[model samples]
Target: MVFESRGEKVFRFAILIVLGLLSVIALLPLLSVISVSFSSGWVVDLNQVTIWPKAFTFDSWQYMIDRPDLWRSFFLTLITTLIGTLLALLVTAMLAYPLAKKEFMIGGILMVGVVITMVFKAPIVPYFLTVRSIGLYDNPLVLIVPHILNPFNLIIMRTFFKQFPKELEEAAFMEGSGYFRLLFSFVLPLSKAVLATLALFYGVVLWNQFQHPLFFITDTDWYPLQIKIRQFITDPNEMPFLASRQEVNYNERTLRSATVVFAIIPVILVYPFLQKYFVKGAMIGSVKG
Candidate 1:
C-alpha cells in the first residue's frame, strides 16, 4: 500500500468518524425498540427504557406468540410476498424481453407509455375506482395482482435483456429452438443475477405492503402483517390480536415495537443471500452498452 500524507490521513480519519457516528445513530433507535419491547409496561410508561432493558421480561413476545390472528397475518404476508415476487418476475421478464428487441415496431411506443406512467402516477381516486371496477375490492388478490409489474424494475430488466448476445438468440432460432424454449433455457439461466435482484425487490415490497391493503381490505382478517402492525400502533385497543391476551400486562409501545421487529426480521434474513447478486445486477441492468 502507498504511504498516506498527513493531510490524507486526517481526511480519512474524519470520514471514518462521521460514518461511525451515523451508524451508531441509526442503530440507537433499533436498540431502543428492542429494549422497550422487553421492558415491563410500567417501566415503558415511565420512559426509562433506553438502549438497555429496564425491567427484563418476555411479556410482549409471549403475547405475540400466543396471538393466533397475528400469526395468520404473518403467514398471509409471507404467502403474498412469495407469490407476488414470482408473478412479478414472470410478467417483468415477458414484457422486458420483447421491448429489448429493436425489430419490434411497437416496442418504443409501448416503452414510452411505460416510462410516462413512471413519471406521472395515476391519481388515487381513479386508481381506487379502477381496482374496484375490476372486482379486486376487499380481496387478498388485490395485494398480489395489481402491483405485479413495477415500471422501474421493468426498465432495468429491459436494459439488461438488451445487452444479451443477439447472435446466441439467432443461432438458437436457426436450430430447432422456439422463442419460449430459448427464453427459459438460455436467457433466464444467464440472467440469474438480475432476476435474483428483482425478486428481492418485489419480495420486500410485497412483505411491507401497507397502503394497498389499508385502502382495499376493510376486513381485519384480510389485513397483512404491516397493516396489523399499523393498527396496533394507531389504536392498541382496536387491535383484535390482543383480545385473548387480556391477562398480559404489555403496553402499546412494547407491543408495537415487537410487531415492527417481527415484520422486519423476515426481509433482513433474506437479504444476505441475494446481496452479492444485487450489486452486480443493479450495475448490469442500469448500464447499457
Candidate 2:
C-alpha cells in the first residue's frame, strides 16, 4: 500500500480552491445580465441589483418578438453567417491543401507569402475601394468575399492537413483517385473536427459583424442584428415603442440590457450544439504542426 504525502494533499486542495474561485468570477457577469433581463420593471435599480431577480417578467423578450424589423435583422444575420462560414471553409481548404504538400513546386514561396500577408494587414480604405471597384460593395457578397480566405484559419487547416498520414495519399494516387475526389471523399471526412471549429468561428464573426454594415451597407432593410442594436441604442426616437414611451419613461440602462440579452441569445443557443466539436477541433488544429 502507498501513502499520500501531507504536502501533496495540501497543494491539490489549493489548486481546486483557485479553480473554483475563477469559475465563479467568470460566471458572475453572465448570471447578472440574465437576471436583469428577466426583471419585471423598466428600470434596474443599481443599488438593489442581485444575482436573483426581485420580480420576474418576460416582457422584454415578448417586445423583441413583436418587432418585425428585429426579426428581419435576425434572419439576415443567420443567412449571412451560414453563407459566409460555408464559403470560408471551402476556400480555406482549397488553399491550405496545396500549401500543405512538401512536394508542391512553389510550396515554400506560397507559404512565405501567406505568412507575410498574415503579418501585414492591408489598409482598410484601399480594400474598401477595391471592393467597390469590383462591384461587391453593399452586396451580400461584400460580407463574405473579403473574409473568405482568412490567413489564420488557412494556416491552422494547412497544419492539420500536414499531419495526415503520407501513406494514405500515396495509396489514393495509386488507386487513380484524382485530387478533387480524394479531397472531398477522404480528406474532408477525416478533417470534420477542425472544419467544424473553423465554421463556428467564421459564423460567429459574420453574425456579430457591425463595422462592415455600418460603413458599406446604407440600406436599413439590409442591416444585421448588431447594427440594429446600435441604432436602437443610439437613436431611441427611431424605435416606435421607445418613441411612444418617451414622455412617460426613458430608462436607457434597461433598454441596453434588453438589447444585449437579445443579441446574446443566438450565440448561447449555438454553443451547446457545437461545443464538443469546438474544443477538439481547436486543440487538433492548433497543437499539431
Candidate 3:
C-alpha cells in the first residue's frame, strides 16, 4: 500500500469531514419529518420531536391511509410514472437510432430544433393555449404527452448510439433483420445501462411532476399526490374536495409530514436497484461521443 504524506493525510481528513457534514445536513430534514410523522401530535406541537420520535404513534399514517382521495392521487401518479417512462424510452430510442446514422439526411436539422428547446422554453401562455387547443385540458395524458421526448435524454441517447458498433448492425442487416427487429433483438439488449439510466431520469420527472398537474388539472379527481398534499397542507381547515369530510383526530402537522414521507417513499425504494446502472450510464453515455 502507498503511504500518504502528512499534507495528503490532512487533505483527505478535511474532505471526509466535509462530506460527513453534508450527509448529515441532507439526512436531518428527512429524519425530522419521519420522526414528526410517527411522534404523537401533542409531542410534535410542543416541538419535542426532532430527528427521533418522543411519543411514537401511527395515528397520522392511519388517518391519511384511510382517505380514498389520497389513494386516488397516489395511484394516478404511479400509473402515469410507469406509462410515461416506457413511452418516453420507446419514442426516444426510435428517434435516436435514425439520428445516430450519419446518412440520415434531415437528422442534423431535427437535432438543431431539439437543442434549441434546451436553450429556450415555450412561453407559458402560448404553451397553455396550444395544449388546450389540442384537447388535453384536464386530461391525464397532458402529463405524459408533453414529456414523451425530452431533449436532454434524446441527446444522451443519440450521443451514446453514435458510438454503437456499425458492423453488428450491418451483420444483422445482412442476416435479413429489419430495423425494428435489429433494435429489439440486438441493439436494445446491449443498451440496458443507458436505458436504465434514462428510465430513472424519466421516472423521476414523471413521478415528481407538480407544476403541470397543478396547472392542467382543475378537476380534483385527476390531481396527483403532490397537489393533493399541497391542498391539505395549505388549507387551515378540512380540504374542500375530501370526500365525507369530518374532523381528523390526527394533528395536521403529523398528517403533513406523513404525506411528504409518502410522496418520498417510492423514489427512496426504487433508486437503489438502478443506482449501479445509473452511475455508469449518466457519466460515460453523456460524454462518450
Best by TM-score: 3
Q: What tens digits encode model 3's per-residue C-alpha lDDT throughout 69-183? A: 9999999999999999999999999999999989899999999999999999999999989998999989999879988999999989998888889999999999999989998
Model 3 ranges off by over 4 Å: 1-16, 239-249
Two-way lDDT contest, 2 vs 3, winner: 3
Clashing pairs in 3: none
- The candidates, ranked best first by lDDT, are 1, 3, 2
Residue-level lDDT tens digits of model 2 in 1-289: 8777999989989999999999999988887777776675544654354666545666666666778998888888888788889989999999889888887899889888988998898898997788789987677667667767888888889988999898998899999998888888899999988898898888888988877887688788888889998888789675446546644332455556677788888888988888888898888778866
lDDT of 1 by residue, 125-161 (tens): 9999999999999999998997799999999999999
Candidates 2 and 3, the one with greater TM-score: 3
**lDDT (0 to 1) per candidate:** 0.89, 0.80, 0.89
Q: Which scores higher on TM-score, 1 or 3?
A: 3
**Model 2 pairs whose backbones collide:** none
Per-prediction TM-score to the true structure, in the order listed: 0.89, 0.88, 0.92
C-alpha RMSD in Å of predicted model 1 compared with the true structure? 3.0
RMSD of each: 3.0, 3.0, 3.1
Per-candidate count of clashing residue pairs (backbone under 3 Å): 0, 0, 0
